[model samples]
Target: MSDIATITAAPIGSFTAEVFAAHLASLGDAPAWWLERKRAAYATFASLPLPTRTNEGWRFSNLSGLQLAGFKVERVDPNGQLLASPFGPAQLNFINNTTVGDGAGARAELAARGVLVTTLSAALQSHPDLIREHFMAQPQKLGSEKFAALHAAFVSDGAFIYVPRGVEVPAPIVITHAASGSGTAVFPHTLVIAEENSKATVVDHFVSVSDIPHSALRTPQFACGANDLYAGHGAQLTYLAAQNWSRDTLSFQFNSTVVRRDARVQSLNLHLGGRQARHESHSQLQAPGAFSEMLALTVADGEQEFDQRTLQIHQAPNTKSDLLYKNALRDRTRTIFSGLIVVDSDAQKTDAYQSNRNLMLSDDAEASSLPGLEIQANDVRCTHGATSSRLDPGQEFYLQSRGIPKAAADELLTFGFFEEVLSRLASEPLHDALHQLIKTKFKQ
Candidate 1:
């Protein structure tokens, strides 16, 4: 193991050199390789500067709202409080970077079938090879490299899931990450690996818990999270992430997906919280017959700002990828959607589509879209577009005339607008769960 003294001392944001040392000390008897990786990641994070206005990757972003100071990493007790999930007993709950519950009995059947569901700390000691192979394996191409490195440096424990070849899991594994207390910072991660011909579903819930009343002062928090999903040849994987942090929190999430030959992967993200939140997703089609479907829905209200960026890369011939993102902006909120699709020279017969749609509910709201395509292959069929529109007065009036109040009418219209993306889900239960969550946000 590398000596802690060998690492140079430096501070970035509220994460100081002392903080990093304390975090390392907390991980008693961790593998040497993992400890060394954290040291290097911290070095990289300190050397890199925060994103500025001149950075093209952060265009139209509220750069001033990207504050990382005044936060500390600490263990928070949830006072016997646990948020309920809509799905099965296969659930893991974490509060303030500490694991509070693990549904072992609920997962016994799947475990007997060669499925692995455990914390990253446990996986580091047992399945070291798998952890080393797929943990943040992809490069940070979406321009949050600094924050991504910081996450790698400070991440303590997260969920790890592995499915062996030809095994099928019937229930969706749920992982919940909650941040409690003011000025608290938490790093949450989930890594999923589905072997050849295997099948599985995983859902992640990001939320906040506080004693503060909703109408009173809201808690301030910081959350930096990332996830990696890999589907082996002919495998099937479905992943969903629901983020509902405190309204005064600042959040960042990065996602990377890899699909192998004849494999299929689908991911849906629902964003409904945070004073300012940014999400980046990248999907790579690495083999022939591979397919990826990426979908997201965001509800930006008040002065909230939701920034989303995505990339679809076609690395092999005969690969397909589809991405659709929808955002509903109300009050004086803002949203930015920037996406690009890249087709390699050898990736002929590639079929790719990208679209971003925004529904404006207030005249003061702002929506910005930047969609681009870069194709080195001449035979590829790729399209990209973005549109921003408001609710039609006729439609709103028609619903109101039928005895529905204006607020109820608007809620109904918004659900109608979001159905296109929700209807694509293969599981009706998951779809309804997400629908109910979004409806709760509307009511708030």
Candidate 2:
């Protein structure tokens, strides 16, 4: 059975040279170095073994559901149109895996303030030094090395934002990564660098272009993605990611965040779709007073399963980190949240917290939470917890007594449960937009 799963996921025909060659041929005037990197990445992709049940990081995940057979990396659907962002802020729209149009609109002032918000490929040429310094510099220390290798092998078109020293952008630089056709594989990458004393927001949106049409036969939406964020001394960066793939998609996204002296970084990942999805996040607080806030929200139903693994490393004195991940499970859906915090021996006064909470909406649903901490600093303040719970029957009844439908009542309570986390977003517009997005997701 495991071999069969591997056959479905590590398909033979999909990783062929002809397919990769065609992808490279389409990239007009690509740099030689990047091409070489991709070539090396492809070799790594082929050599790496498929993650099996024996892998400790993949524990509690349904390995058989990870199927990549019949998938191919192809050109975007030429005939398909991309959907607009539902609630408008600053928008960058990608149609058929290509960023078709983008507009800061009223937020154009951000560009005037010495902020460079452009596609990663564009940024590579325009701001080579910064991209060279930060892009994928962190090693894949997490257990998703295979997926990271695959992402490196195929990644194209993603956003790269650089905020100069002491410049603060009022608006979020939004990036949308849309996968259009079935059996179509895309690699989306994002790199964010906030210089010292700068403040900015970056949002990455991954969605299936339901309005698009596929021109080819036997295609699927199979994608691998990665995002790297660097916060310089005293800089503040906030990142929001909303991932919604098609039901038939197999997806993996790896996120690496590095925080420097006195810098602060807050990131939230929201997962709403995909048949099988795995997200790995790693944060390293590398200097004194650096802080990181990691948050995620997932809605799983219809046999969907989300596996998340996270690590918070405190490498310097007085650094801090707090992680809060909440999952609401319905039907036979399952979710796994495993997180750890490690404090170095010299990192005295380190403060870390990790919490995973689950709200069960169906009797058959399952949610697993594992929170651990390795504190070598005896003087540090560290805490970790996991709570698996159900909707409060009283709370449900209270809403129902107001003539609310049971489903709506449950949803309302679920929203209340998530509101605590959403409230963490300091941006009012962003908070409201994400809240409305979740509400719309529930309606669907």
Candidate 3:
């Protein structure tokens, strides 16, 4: 049998090749220009080589295991359960890469206001214009172009959210993606566009339907995905994402948020699974008064490794961006966080801050942080800092004195430590939901 290790050459006529071909053929006859763009993107992807140690954006990233040597993308069958992962005032679910659960006449209400919430495939057939305008619109310049290309090549389904101008969603929207098969490869994309003066909150959850053994694994599937957030003038957008892929898979996620004039955008990502998972996020403050807040949390256990990199660019004067990422490492796991803040020459009065803090739960775990800044505007205030340390023994002891077990004490203290970031979530239900998810992590 030919194994992944022995496969050195790319096979153009493989099953995935046919799958990609079918994707192109089934496009409901899109504009020639769009199809041409897809062809161009595929060509670019096939032409670019994987990142190496010398690449600055990939520095400190574990790249050897990123080989496309194994795995084939396929459709996941019917699966998923109504997991009660702390719900907010509203909820939406995506089970096994498909939509599920309709609550509170939500679909009708959104439709009434011209807000369209539908599957990516359905939207591809119905709202081709929207997809044509914003699908993978931004340049993938963050050094993850290879994975982004893979996502574009194989992606067939995802969530499409379009908030019309001046519409304000009263409740937060929830989306969940769960894997069911033993060796499943799923690609989930979320594209959200908030028009002028609109407001919306979207929470995305990625989970596994079954708990695969981490220490003993057979086939290691790959998870390649992307998310895009577009906010127009005076708009407000909040996104909360939790990634809980199968414990033995390779995962890559690239997310970008574009903030327009006077727009406010906040995104929070939580990482907890996969043998080797790398996440990259980029946010651009494109105009004056634009603000962005980025928050991320990771819990690395066993031999798992979570690598994360981020960038915040103040492209216009008086723009602001604040980033805070926290990680908790247990067992012999490893994590790396390298981030940067850039203040352009025209970005006068730019206020940008970048911070990464790690809480070590075991002596064998490792956490690395590198924070930097490039500021060309003399009048801007830009700062970056990275810190890695163990849990505060004093705080642990204080909780223990109150009759809490040592493990419980440590968990409680850790939760308190993360509250500062979680509290920033404007939705109470989302904050509580995230708190519950973190609580379950300590029990594992």
Please report the candidate that would top TM-score against the real structure: 1
List the lowest-lDDT window of 10 residues for candidate 3: 4-13
TM-score of each: 0.96, 0.93, 0.90
Clash-forming residue pairs, model 3 = none
Question: Which structure among the candidates has the greatest lDDT?
Answer: 1
**Candidate 2: residue pairs that collide:** 182-219, 182-220, 183-219, 183-220, 183-221, 184-220
Residue-wise C-alpha lDDT for candidate 2, range 1-444, written one tens digit per residue: 656564645543376667767777776666777778778877877776666778888789886666556777776554445556643543565554466764655335666777777777777678777766787778876577867877776776777787999998876778878777667777888898999999988888887765425322113477688999999999999999998787667789899999999999999999987878889999999999999999999988787889899999999999999999999898999899889898999999999999999999999998887777888887898889999899988988899999999999998898899988999998888888788777866776
* Sliding window of 10 residues with minimal summed lDDT for model 2: 211-220
Error of 3 at 193 (Å): 0.8
- 1 or 2, greater by TM-score: 1
> Residue 440: error of model 2 in Å?
2.2
Sort every candidate by TM-score, greatest first. Answer: 1, 2, 3
Residue 136, model 1, lDDT: 94
lDDT per prediction? 0.90, 0.81, 0.79
Tens-place lDDT per residue, model 1, 54-152, is 788899998767767789986666664566765544367888888886687766766888898888998999998998999999999989998899999
